[model samples]
Every structure is written in structure tokens, then in C-alpha cells.
Target: MQTVEHESFGSPTEIREFPHGHAEILNVGDATIGRLVLEPGWRWSNDVKPIAGTESCLAPHFQYHVQGRLGIRMDDGEEFIAGPGDVTSLPEGHDAWVVGDEQVIVVDWFGATDWAKEPAGNVAAHA
Candidate 1:
């Protein structure tokens, strides 16, 4: 049996920030979760790519859109939009951006533990 635990994103265990976006991470048992707050005009490639050093987002995400809207484009060119109340499982190698003027908030059940980690040799950038 396992002991029950309670956690809050309000005082996250970890926080990573980048241009126009940020992720607040929490841990429960063996799983890690993140609450991402992406501002309007935030884009994975444009904001996070410099730190990630990847052509596209390589973090596989299983997420719930909590508020506002977001757009995703896969490396292969497939594109879609996600709004509040939507659940999405995005594979690696994709780009995501906030849609319209709304700030997008999402809860990621996967990929948060390693997302937005500072790139090699980039000291104290974000994490």
C-alpha cells in the first residue's frame, strides 16, 4: 500500500520559465505533473527552441487544456487546434503556440519532469 499525498501547483516543487511561457511542476508518488501557462504569441520553436537546441519540441505530451486555446503543428505538417476541455496526446517532434490573445493554461500528465531543462552549458538560464 502507498500513502496518500497532497500537492499544489501554487507552490510548485519546480518551475521553469522561458520567453512568454512557464511551467510549474509538482510531484505525486512516482509521477510528475506540470501546469503550463503560455502567454499569447508564445511558440515552442520561437520561444523554447533556443534553449532546447532542437528543431522541434521533442517532449511527448499527454495534456489537458485548462483554459484558452493552443495550436499544434507536427513536424510532418499536420496542424490542429486545442481549446479548453480538450485532451491531447502530442508525440515528440511538434511545435505548439498560443492561439489568439488568450493565455493558454494546460496540465501535462507526461513530459513535465524533463521539459524546459536548461541546455548543456547554459547555466542558470531556466529550470
Candidate 2:
């Protein structure tokens, strides 16, 4: 029997911003999907401000909004809004930004291997 407690990991962390305030974590597991809960006023950057080697490239982001609102916009003038219980697949080379004063919890299903490439110091802040 094996169990991994969430609190055992200490605090939530932020990996790095890509584009449009949307940050990401690499090495996201395949069996266990990455979960992200955004609080009120929680705004993520998607500009890839810190993620190295991604400025010229794009990240493949797929997420589902459980109980809040989320917005995704790409550099090519593409955008979309997601609400509670909404499942969405973000287009490659785009940015995602949260909205509203509600708590938004997004369970990312891109596998657990994705978060392995996040920023250290700023990681917990992204939570």
C-alpha cells in the first residue's frame, strides 16, 4: 500500500511562466494528473517570462476547470472562456489567465511528468 499526502509536499509551488501569465510544471505524472487551485485574484502569467528555451516555442497545455472561470488567449488572436465543470484543451503556443473572485480548481491531465520543469523559488507562489 502506498499513499502520498498532499500536505507532505509542504506548500504549493509555481514552475514558470510561459505566455499570457500561464505557468507550468514539467514531469507531470501519467497516472496522476496535476491539480491546480486558483484563489480569488489569482492571476497566472502566460508570457513564458521565466521558462527557458520556450520563448521561441510553445507548451502543450490541457486542463479542466472544476469550479471557477478561466480564460485562454493565443498570440494569433484566438481566445476562449471556461466555466465550472468545463473541460478544455488549450491550443499550443497560447496563454491562460484566470478570472472572477471565485476559487478556481483546475485538474490538469497532461500527466504528472509535466511539473518536473518548474521554477524553484517562485514555485510555491504560483499556488
TM-score of each: 0.92, 0.57
TM-score of 2: 0.57
For all the candidates, what are their Cα RMSDs to the real structure? Answer: 2.9, 6.8
Q: What digit string (tens of lDDT, one per residue) describes model 1 on residues 73-118?
A: 9999999999999999988889999999999999999988778877
Candidate that scores best on lDDT: 1
Which residue pairs overlap in candidate 1's backbone?
A: none
RMSD of 2: 6.8
Error of 2 at 52 (Å): 5.8
lDDT against the true structure, each candidate: 0.89, 0.52
Error of 1 at 18 (Å): 0.7
